[model samples]
Target: MRKELYVYHEGKPVQAVIRTYTERDFDGLIEVQRVSFPPPFPEELWWSKEQLTEHVVRFPEGALCAEVNGVLIGSMTGLIVSDEAVEEAHSWSAITDDGYIRNHDSTGHTLYVVDICVVPEFRKTGIGKWLMQTMYETVVQLKLNRLLGGGRMPGYHLHAGEATPEEYLERVLRGEWNDPVISFLLRCGRVPVGISEQYLEDEQSLNYAVLMEWRNPFNSSSL
Candidate 1:
């Protein structure tokens, strides 16, 4: 069954219906990805509507989409990679010269966040947070303890040895990195573990992605 999600900002409610992806939704998802990313992946890489429907039918929980007014504004897809699967892949690599898969499994689960994207015009309005919160809720419901993915943090190092924090704030306000989103995640207790040195090549930019584990304050075990 498909789930529904909603988020409110300053008393104005925004509806985000969470459901399995369809072919029609792929186009909108592609548009969102293109606008949100630099050197967007080729459109040909995306599955068609029929292919999306077929894939979802086979793996319903692996695909999810968020739509507002029947239009997809954002989406996220993930899979739980098990340690056994990782080991099997490694064994096969010995027969062939393929690269080894780095499988980091904790609590018997490794969440692979394939992608998460939000449209530009509707950004900074809590849509991204809502989508993530919804994802977390779903994870918890499935009895998972951790969520892993890449997120953008402020480019504080860009002004290395030159600008102060105040100057960095100015650059941030001028539509630099999405600082508020990073702040929200930090406030939610997400911690940074590492970064990708060459996450982006076209813009000569790198992504400071961190692996954040969800901690429940009220749970004694979590503390």
Candidate 2:
């Protein structure tokens, strides 16, 4: 694993530590998720710190974190998935078993990118991008078959009053409009498959999400 990462602040590069999650990182990752995800859902929908720990406990290799000067700032979590459910339409709660990571399957080849988050203070920095790239690298390195990267369309909230999820995704893909989250995800090689309603109760996206598939060509060629 790579140990050093650099992110920018006000156009200046700063050093950051990138590593896998340790038991001590539990509280920090939960805190990051809380601040990163803006909401429209009830308080009951939130994942408590203990719940987050369970994910790391079940699949430590699937979870990663970034820290700068010893302060935790970003994280990405995922779980292995297989069976017909991987191709069929599924909501975030369904895949995560309502946020418990109970669906994690080590025998599976598909890595379900459940969450990628960076604290607000670190926004606009390249840390989010790096975290994503790291996950992409992971998919390739692990020789996984594909990545089900569920990306939030936070910018969708701003335009939800004007268009449907399909319309918005079409516009974004066609270069007619831009969505901060989904748009970038596509650029990172995540291709939209469809939309999942109630996937997340994210106020920014109105409980809607764009499902994307990224296949690892290298893994297939060697098979």
Top TM-score hit? 2
Tens digits of per-residue lDDT for model 2, 1-223: 5579677887899998777887787778767766775564344555577677777789877788999988889888888888566677778878977667887887888888877778889987878878877777788888888888677888887787799999999989899888988877876778888888888767788888888877788886424
Q: What is the C-alpha local distance difference test score of each model?
A: 0.52, 0.80
The window of 10 residues in a row where model 1 has the poorest summed lDDT is: 92-101
Output the worst ten-in-a-row residue range by lDDT, candidate 2.
38-47
Cα RMSD of predicted structure 2: 2.5
| Clash tally, candidates in order | 1, 0
